[model samples]
Each structure stands twice: as C-alpha cells, then as structure tokens.
Target chain A: MARVVVDVMPKPEILDPQGQAVAGALQRMGVAGVADVRQGKHFELEVDDALDDATLHRIAGELLANPVIEDWVVSRTP
Target chain B: MRIGVITFPGTLDDVDAARAVRYAGAESVALWHADRDLEGVDAVVVPGGFSYGDYLRAGAIASIAPIMTEVVAAAGRGMPVLGICNGFQILCEAGLLPGALVRNAGLHFVCRDQRLRVETSDTAWTGDIEAGSEILVPVKNAEGRYVADAATLAELEDTGRVVFRYVGGNPNGALADIAGISSADGRVVGLMPHPEHAVDTLTGPSVDGLALFTSVLRASATT
Candidate 1:
C-alpha cells in the first residue's frame, strides 16, 4: 500500500488565534512548559501511483482545503 | 455591467457566481486563471473553491496566475472586484486587501446557513443595503476563520471597512461573526459566505444574498 501524507499551515501573514488561545489555556492550566503553538492539519491517503501530480493537485484545491485560510502539502510513496 | 468570473482549475463556485451576476442584470463572462485579458468586463469576481488545490496555500498558487496579475492591475484602475471564500484568500495573496484568512478555532469543516450584518454597505457590490441590515447566506468551509492582527483589525473597525459581520448564533461557531469586508475605496469586496448560493429563492437559503448582487446593479446603473 502506498502512503500519502499531507501537511497544512496558515500563510505567513495570517494570524493564528487558535494556536495562541491554546497556549494561553496551557498557561492558565498551570503548565508553563509550552513555548508556542501554531495549529495546522495533516492527512494520509493510501493510494496507488496511478494518479499524476496534476490530478492530485486538483484534489487538493477542490475539497481538502478552503484555500482562503489554509494550505496543504501532499506526498506519495512508491 | 459585464462581470467576469475568474475560474481557476479547482474553482467550485464560478458558475454560481456567474449566475448571480446574470440574475443581477449583468453579463457574466468567463475568465481563466492563466489568461491575461479580462475581456473588457466592468467587474471581476474571484469565485470560491479550491484553486491550485489549496496546495502551497489557499489562493497562494492561483494568485500567481497570469490572469490574476491583470486582475490586480485592473483593480488598481478602479474595476470593482469581489471574492468569496477561496477568492477571499486569493485577494489577500495578491495583496489587494490587507490581512489574511486563517483556520477556524475548532479545526473542523463547517457548513450551514449563516447570518451576517451589513457593517459597511457603501461598497460597489453592497451599496444597496443599509449598514446594520442583517442577511443570511450559506457558509461551507474548513478554514473559514478570519484572522488579522490587533492593529489591522482596529484600523478596519475605525475606518468602517468591514462589509459584513457574522450574526453569532450560527450552528457552527465562527469568531467575531465576521462574514465579509471591502476595500479602502469600497470598490473591492470579499466575504466568507457563499452569497451565490442564496441568490435563488426556491433553492437558496435566503433572498438576502440577492441584494448583494442587485446592489452591484444599482451601482452600475447609477455610474
């Protein structure tokens, strides 16, 4: 089985409030060990290499991410 | 006004946006992401959906397309522009609007009918509605959260640049209830909700979204 991995992140200019809030919550919970938290997304798909990069890119733009707020990366293994 | 709907490879709502423009008495022209010409259209719409597959970033890859380069120039020349969802992302990527869109607090895909107040309606696309008027539209997105720095947010609020505010009681919890925004000159508008989905009374969530399209009609007619 082939393994596909995806990682998502906010654009550099965009603020990440959720990550900030979580860090704040961690601090409030008396956990001082956390330094920072930037939230993102990751996905893994098991698929054959029959799909080309263009087709896979189309899948990324069509449904996996909003394109407005998030970015994604896809990798496949032989 | 002849409106051009820019369709990137993964755009999901260009057809709907085009239909909404037609319903508003404007001719909808199809524009491809790679083309440089806008075909003399009076306005341009960067419709919603995944462009370049949200790879690299939402609107990031599509922002570099040749057509977007021209769209930016035309926007500089005062052509009215509107972006919804993914389109909003591209606008930011292209630097036509300030700030950027970020992830939702909950990290889950959200889909539902949303309520939004007309925070600023002096825009070319929103002028028909009075400020503070509430309207409903459909919002379906995974990264629909709107994030800008405190300074920028303050500036937006002080200048009344905000075009729409989320009505808060949504089925999905979106922050600050922000739904849309406009450019400094009110020529460019962007929003997270799918106003096109609300254009038809029979199949739409509410006719409230139609006013946005109609407002453009009024602006074009008066101009």
Candidate 2:
C-alpha cells in the first residue's frame, strides 16, 4: 500500500476570504510577523502500490482540486 | 412542455424549482442524480442545495454524477438547461459554464432580495425578459462569488454572454457583479440567485422570476 498527499490551494490570483478571516483573527489574538494567510485543502489517499503517478495526478487534478480556481501538489508519503 | 428538476441527495430546492416550472404552465419531472436517463424532458433544471454535503467542494461531486453525464450531452445538442444556486456551481464545475463560484468576498452566507439587471435576453432562460430590465430575486449562498481568469472574463464581456448583472449592489463580490451567465450557445445558463423561490410574490420578493421559467417554455415552443 502507498499513501499519497495532495495539497490544494487557491490560485495566487484568486481571492481567499477564509484565509483573510484567519489572518484577521490572528491579528486580534496579538500574533505578529505574519505576511498573509491563504486557505486550502489537504487530502490523503491510500492506494495500491501499482497505481501509477499519472493516474494519481489525474485523480488529484480532476477531483481533488478545481483547476479553474485552485492548484494542487501531489507527493508520496513514506 | 416538460422540464426536469434534478434532485441530488443534499439538494434542498428541487421541490421549489419543480413548483416554479408548474407555475410557468409546464409539467415538472423529477430526476435522480444516480439515473443516466433524462426521461425525454425538453429541458433540465439543477436546483440548489449542498449536494454530497459539499464534500471536496460545493457542487464538485454532484457535477460528476450519472445524471450530469446525460445533462452535458443534452446540453451539447442545444437543449436548454438552467442551474440555480448550488446548481450553478455544479454547472461551472461541470464546465457547462465558464468560471467558478467561490467563497463570498464577505466570507459570510448572504440571503436577501437582490436586484439584477437583465444583461441579455437572448439566452433560453432569459428570453421573456427585456435586456436591461431589473428584476428582484432572492439571493442566498455562502460561496456565490463568480470567478474566472482574466481572459475568460474578457471574452464573456466581449461576447455579451453575461446574463444577469447585479443592479443595486453586489451581494457576493462576484467579478464584474455578474449574477448569472450563459454558455456560448445561450442554451445553458447558471445563476447564483434563487429564481425558483421568487416565482410568486407570496413566497418571494417579486413575481419577476416567473419570467425565467416562462422564457424557457417559450423557447421550447418555438423550437
């Protein structure tokens, strides 16, 4: 079995209101030195070792993230 | 005329959408998400709700349902399809429409009577209304902001595909205050507001939304 992790984030040009809200809260809580915050999704999947990287990429690109508004990175976990 | 109103597991507005179709003097057919058949309905309406609990993303799962495969095919042949609220998101996710509906700029669920200007009445869904006329409808959603890349945005603007433009004030911070848009052929349309909920004055802000339903019926009759 193999575990894959996909990290999806809104594209740089897209607005991230939820992330901004978190940034605001952090400011109120007296946290500093933060440049900005952008929210995203993280997905972990367990699949057969035979699953190829191309197939995994298709899954991540087609289902895990919306290409129109977000970008995703897939990495295998040990 | 017969119109199909699709119901996914978490759909909340199918009944209301069906009722709106009936009020427009058409028969409403209930369609299931898992079914591959369209039941020979002249048009389809994908209504609002958190389908699949909005897992992954709102409208993401539902957009790939068995029914949508048929919906996309039918739409390709120029069949009229109207997607409201979450349905709009599904249509975008399904690539039936251009752009994506994202978190509202305010980051809050907005529910209110919104005024929108009819940008173009050339589409199947807005044919009964005059272009530039303003209509009041109920807008409700957390992720109602419409977003597209700059090129797509320019194309939509250049081609006059924007169907509805927020009139009074933009409720969701959608780019260009776009409340609704249509496909290149104008047979497919998706909008964030709840036009189904506004077909009657008793339940909605105005009877203006009835025109959308009537418009499709009129389009069907001529075709």
Candidate 3:
C-alpha cells in the first residue's frame, strides 16, 4: 500500500472570513500591527515511504490544493 | 431505502429534511444529536438548519455532536453525505470536507431562489447528472460564504471536485466567484444551496432540486 499524505488549504482568491473577523476584533481590542491573518488546516501523513516527493507533490497540488487560491507544504514523516 | 437524517439541538430543518427524504420514496431515520448509532441506513443527509443556533460559528458546535461519530464513520465507509447550508458548515467544521462557511460577505441575511451550475456529477451523490447542468435552488443564510486557504481551492477545481458553482450574476464572496466544493472522494459533497426546499415543484422555485436526491439514489445503485 502506498501511503501519501494530503494537506489542503483554501485558495488565495477565497476569503478567510473567520480569520478576517478575528483580526477586526483584535484591532478593535487595541491589538496593534496585525498585518494579516490567514487560517489553514494541517495534516500529518503516514505513507508507504516508497513514493518520492514529486509523486506526492502531484497529489497535493493536483487533487489536494486549489492552486488558484490555496497553497500547501508537504513533508515526509514515518 | 433507509436514509439517516440527523437532528441536533437547535436544528430547524431536520423534520422537513426527513419529510423530503420520505417523499422521495426512501425511509427517513431520525438520528439524535447525542446518539452515535446510525440505525442501519443506506445513506445519510446532514440536512440544513440553524444547528446550535449559529453560535460560535454555524455548524461549529454541531460538528462535534455525539451522533457525528457515526456520521463521520459512515461517510468514510462510502455512505453518501450531503450537507446543506448549515450542514455544509458542519462538514467544514468537522474537517470531513474543506473550507468554512462564514457570514455572507455583505453581512446580510441572504434569502433567494439562487441558480447553480453543477460542475461535476461524478460522486456518490451526483453520479446521475451531467456536468455543466444548471439547477435552481433556494438559499437562505446569514452566514453562508465559503472560505478556505488558497491551495485548497485549486485542488478542488483542478480535480473536478467543485461539484457546484453559483450562477454568474454574483462573484464568489464578492471577493471572487466560488460557491461550493467537495473532497477528493465524491462520496462527500458540500454546497451552500438548499436543495431540500426545491425538491417539490409546487413548493419551490423549481423541481430541479429533486434531481440531486434522485442522483444520489442512482449513485448508490451504481456503487
């Protein structure tokens, strides 16, 4: 079995309304210098260890992340 | 023919959702929020409603419902999961699917007969339909805008995972024009539109929404 980890995020074009809302609340609470707030999810993968970085990257980019608006970072772990 | 419809505290649509399922010739099994059993149903519908009263965030609380354990497990086992407005919120909150449903970008309670284009019909739910088909359904929500990090959107679009998109009149989020998306597996589908409200031709803007349910039936048979 080939184990590949898929970590996904929202696209750039899509708005992180929750993060933006919190940022606004923070600004109102007198928190200064909050340049930006982007929210995303992180996943830990336990893969077969046979697939190379390129193949895994293909899955993450092509089916895992929406390149137009989202970006992802893939790493290997036992 | 048995379909499980879950009811969580503050859920306003579970009854109607059950009725719609029954009307569609399937037995509707009412599942409680705190219960973990699915009652041996063939499929599941996480119907729309104001679960947990949209507190914290819509579907945020309901996502953790006790019954959600079974719902999530069943969904993973290839049971078709359809999340409506609030249900869509739960799916994202539960991490069953990606993206969050935030308040409408304009910050107003948007209620209207919205038109949608079915971008992909190849899923455990939408397998009977053709891509690019137009569907008219009702949408009512104060917080229904979908948000996610950039990379997630690309993967959804690139893989035909975006099952539905709003008609071209309004751009997505007013920031851009995105409507709804699905996971890599077609079994789980999340969309902002309310297909339940449009299931009956006489009771809705159109009967096109019935196709969504019937499509699921077809998908189930094919599977």
RMSD of each: 8.0, 0.7, 8.9
Candidate 3: residue B72 lDDT (0-100): 88
Top candidate (DockQ): 2
Per residue, candidate 1 scores C-alpha lDDT tens digits across B1-223 of 7899999999999999999988888899999998989999988989999998988567878877999989999989888899999998889778888766656656667888888889877898888888888888998887667666667678888888888888866433344566777888888888889889898988888877778888877776766
For the record, the alpha-carbon RMSD of candidate 1 to the native fold, in angstroms, is 8.0
- Model 2 chain B: lowest-lDDT 10 consecutive positions: B194-203
**Against the true structure, whose TM-score is highest?**
2
Put down candidate 2 lDDT per residue, B1-223, tens digits, no spaces: 9999999999999999999999999999999999999999999999999999999999999999999999999999999999999999999999999999999999989999999999999999999999999999999999999999999999999998999999888998899999999999999999999889998878999999999999999898888
Top candidate when judged by lDDT against the true structure: 2
Per-residue CA lDDT of model 2 for A1-78, tens digit only, reads 999999999999998999999999999999998879999999999999999999999999899999999999999998
Report the C-alpha lDDT of model 3 over B186-215, residue by residue, as the tens digit: 888888788888877788898777776777
Tell me the spans in candidate 2 whose CA falls farther than 4 Å from its real position: none
The lDDT, on a scale of 0 to 1, for candidate 1 is 0.81
Task: List runs of model 1 lying over 4 Å from the truth.
Answer: A1-78, B170-175
| Ten contiguous residues minimizing lDDT sum, candidate 3 chain B | B168-177
- Positional deviation of A6 in candidate 3, in angstroms? 29
TM-score, candidate number 3:
0.74
lDDT tens per residue, model 1, A1-78: 577776777656556767888899999999988998888878777776676788777667545554545678887855
